[model samples]
Target: MTYSGSNYRGAASVPPAGGSGGARVAAAAGGGPTRRGLIGSAIGLVASVAAAGGGFSVWSTANDANSDLDRAFDLGDLEDRPEDTPALNVLILGSDHREGNAEEDARSDTAMIMHVNEGGTEAYAISIPRDLYVPIPEDPDAAYYPDYTGTNAKFNAAYAWGGVNTTVKTVEALTGVRIDHIVEIDFNGLIEVVDALGGIDIDVEVPEGQDTVTSIHEPYREFSEGVNHLNGEEALDYVRQRKQYADGDFARMRHQQDLIKAIMDSALTAGVLTDRGKLTAFIESTSDAIKVDTDFNVVGTAIELMGLRSDDIVFMTTPNLGTGDQGGESVVIYADDPENPEASNPEAVSLWEALREDTMAEWVEDNPEAAGQDEGE
Candidate 1:
């Protein structure tokens, strides 16, 4: 899926998927159009946070089809998240393994930080290229994980070397932002979630000769694009089709962001909140496919997320101005500036810094209204 700036407008108009399924809570206070009203909204937001506190209980009590034992790790005592922290940074990892694959563990095809501002009015998501070189920490002795001597390697390799903790540590070291939570979704689980919400509508800007690329799966084949509706399998291929594009993974990140926005729009429009059975089933199908720290649970997460509207989400790539080979492997280097050295790259470091400072209000003041919602509400 390819979206120009205009496409962002259309995406904002799409309502959120709503159903009685999954965990549901009251609408957050201060969510309506008043600056002081946001305080009430913040209180309601805490309720949602409280609900998320019990997310695991909801997952455990819900359906368990295709569940994996490895996906069930607890968050321990990592709480103490400051209520005033301007942004909540969540590390979302997409593993590239499907059912019946010989490989027990799959490489992460995608890694991103979903930054939600303190006010919850604006969100910024930035993707980390899997190939970018980064330092990996030593592995735990009891876990039998690979130990790295702090040598630079592909970003994704950190996960294979140590697991989620190592990946979080590596990213924290790179960005200087503390990750409040982590979520992993596998290929099968992603397809199932998309299917459950119904297919997402995506606008594909078909470049000339786009039809030459063949499809990966048998039933869902690739086709010429220009506003196409995609099912789960087809959407998976849509975002994962880096080989066919000249821009490689950079293009893939754009498509991935588009797919995510599409899913959020469709899911909200479908009223997933009101449909309890469907929500429960959808959660069950995806539960085993994901791994989150113990502190994160469905109830609290639902509450925290409930405060957000589709317009609240923002997506961009890391700023890259140069490319070169490190250790005989290709890598993309983030320029100190992409738009202008004096001006920060909206894609990478600056956006993160804005989130870290909880200054999205200021950022939004600088950026044109993209979400189309009332500002400061």
Candidate 2:
């Protein structure tokens, strides 16, 4: 369970190229597909060739997208993460924003903590509710805008108030873990990525209802449920719709995780990693919407992460059951207590601890049914 940073092959001893102090870890560990001299030599060669001719270009263009996205928001000063850390925690923020999306800019609809073990073989993602009440950090140096008020506010508002830095800091304070990277993707990018992959297949447990706008200004549409294959827009609607579900944002988070699993499964089956054109397009189209820490480069990081199989990844929500009043606002509390565990039980914490220690296979062994499904591409 003790992860040695030295075991990772691609992490730069010094700083990575083209970034502040962020280190790029090569993807050779059990995390993704980082086998160097070819386990499947023929396929590797073909993939390499395809990648060089098209995949690499697509990746470069995708980097351009990141550059374009940077113009719209303030990417905080890069944090210098020490190399010896046991796990790399990344805050994955999914925004509802689209082109000229003024209304959606007010909040972050989805948030998840992606914890990748230092060795890179395993990953555990824990989704956090957007409506959770937390204190917004104050920015003393801002000349144009005064510091934020209120002791506690909805978590998503952190992004609207001070952008990524504030959100990251807030989450770090909440989780007691330092985030090594932050990746934010918007609705347009999500749709494009799904489309680039030829649409993702997802299983809808509850039947989907149509969204009929009461007024012309509101968006309206309908969706049929029951394990239907969803295209880009439908998939977006599937994850974004919450009013129909009883749990609202909580249900939406579960649906989002389900969609991600489906996407991963489909991507694996479609051989997206080997398909140079599709892979490049996927990266390029999504690049603009994705904002990562200076240390995280998609291509370089993915290349290092190639060792990870779909089955190796595990996803869960933060253990929470009841609601409470914080600062006169309703909020979900994560893990009320260790002894009398409610939603955030010791089991959930232990699950995360197991993930940080790279002992997730043990956890999966106990839950064979959940582990049995085919991890789509």
What digit string (tens of lDDT, one per residue) describes model 1 on residues 1-377? 11112211111111122322222222111211000000112212222322332344343433132123133443343333333343456677777766786333657758877665544445566677777655555445212255562556777777666656667767766665777666666666567766776676877644356643455556546556766787777777767666667777776776776666565555555355455565555555445445555444333334435544444555555555546676577877544422233343344455556656767556655653432234486
For residues 217-267, what per-residue lDDT tens digits would candidate 2 score against the true structure? 135555545577877777776676666665766666767777766655655
TM-scores for all candidates: the values are 0.69, 0.68
lDDT of each: 0.51, 0.51
Q: Model 2: how large is the Cα RMSD against the reference?
A: 8.6
The lDDT of model 2 is 0.51
Candidate 2 regions with alpha-carbon error over 4 angstroms: 1-84, 101-104, 141-146, 207-219, 271-276, 326-328, 335-377
